[model samples]
Target: MAVQDLLRQRFFPHMWCPGCGHGTVLNSLLRAVLELGLSKNEIVMTSGIGCSARISGYVDFHSLHTLHGRALAFATGVKLSKPELTLLVPMGDGDALAIGGNHFIHAARRNIDITAIVMNNRIYGMTGGQFSPLSGIGVKATTAPYSTIDNNFDVVELATAAGATFVARSTTYHARECTELIKKAILHKGFSVVEILSQCPTHFGRKNREGDAGQMLENYKKITAKRGSKALEENPGLIGRGIFVEKEKPEYCQEYEKTIALAMKGAGR
Candidate 1:
């Protein structure tokens, strides 16, 4: 289907701030869905309260706009009840790694067949410029007037350690690559986590003096190297992008079915 067909056009004049990287992420996600030939009925998108969560409102797919940091929990229920449907849960840094953090780790640990998209813009854009879990130390936010002293969680590492079967990282600057990564994540049969380093020009940029959106995109290009590249080897400070992990594992829903069958047979039902 065409990308436009997947959109809820009446909701146009999107809510995201001008130059916000979340828009790019939405665009990339739409293209990925279209490229995968996924029908609206075949996919379900869930989101928690935040700027990133607004994506659910824009897409025409079956969607659940749930409470702060609970999108994954709601999605887990949906996937378990209806294993035939594809689940996509998109969340902001705070929405994904802060209040919703427990759900995020457990979901990954379960190896459920869900696509978790963490749009790490570093600040809580929807609720003022508050520093988030992914906002590394030294970054400025409204809650961190003197800069944050707290270290940030490396999303790729966190997801990997939590037992996600598919983990990848990309940035809004690498939009086409982000789309490709999302497509692959959707096709993976087990838990998949894709962290997109989205930029929040209004909150994160203004607070940190990170220049305008264009400059922020350029910064992403400068600061990130492809996975396994010599540049990454030479510059330890630079972040690496691209798929970090992909391997087979027993999916939660499928395993649950086996357990149910065993119970039924033992009961002689």
Candidate 2:
């Protein structure tokens, strides 16, 4: 647990640019929140406005730094005002799918328990490059300087069709399989989306020349080994990274605690 005492070194100089895969996704998300021992006041780390929302100002614990794409609506009001906080929502890709695409599809269709680490890096590296919504459908940024002819929003198939129980995709040159798919999307209960695939390499590596940072981690290790053997020969169809989705619904704080116990037992007093 000595990872510089779980970082927040007074926000020590991390604005994320040097061949930035958002600092290998903030060092595999502080080693998957210190290997899930949790507690640093139970973790919050929300974010928004670009450069991966400056990683909630270097993460000491209980961060916000909001309002670019509204960081899953301020991480759904800090997990519905502390429903046992562990809500780590790091964003990017134009602050989560182009101006927070309807708050990332209504916080994954209200399955919002929140793990959402989406450093997609497909352009728009802090308001200069532009063209995001995942940016791969042709690619050339600075408002698609002759390439991106639309069509590119596959953020784990739009967070498993916006009902996100758990969704995965990893990159940043596989930083330990993107920290074990963000440590199984923080012990999955409900809304969990990973979708990292980072590496801007200074505005998508000088517009696809893709040179330094070891040739963009050797073209992301040959595009994640040909997209991980075509997602194991397309088993269950088109699943790209590991753990494409895991189910078990009923989360948004256990269905908002059963609708506040049926509105306090129908106000019987």
TM for candidate 1 is 0.98
Residues 180-249, candidate 2: write the lDDT tens digits: 8899899888789888888887878888778877688777766554345754565544336677779988
CA lDDT for candidate 1: 0.94
Q: List where candidate 2 sits over 4 angstroms from the true fold.
A: 1-14, 23-77, 82-88, 91-112, 118-164, 172-189, 195-211, 221-223, 226-243, 246-248, 257-259, 266-268
Q: Which stretches of candidate 1 lie above 4 Å from their native place?
A: 266-269
Query: Clashes in candidate 2: how many?
Result: 0
Please report how far candidate 1 places residue 212 from its true position, in Å.
Answer: 1.0
lDDT, model 2, position 212: 75
What are the lDDT scores of the predictions, listed in order? 0.94, 0.81
Q: Candidate 1, residues 83-188: lDDT per residue as tens digits?
A: 9999999899999999999999999999999999999999999889999989999998999999999999999999999999999999999999999999999999
The TM-scores, one per candidate, come to: 0.98, 0.37
TM-score of 2: 0.37
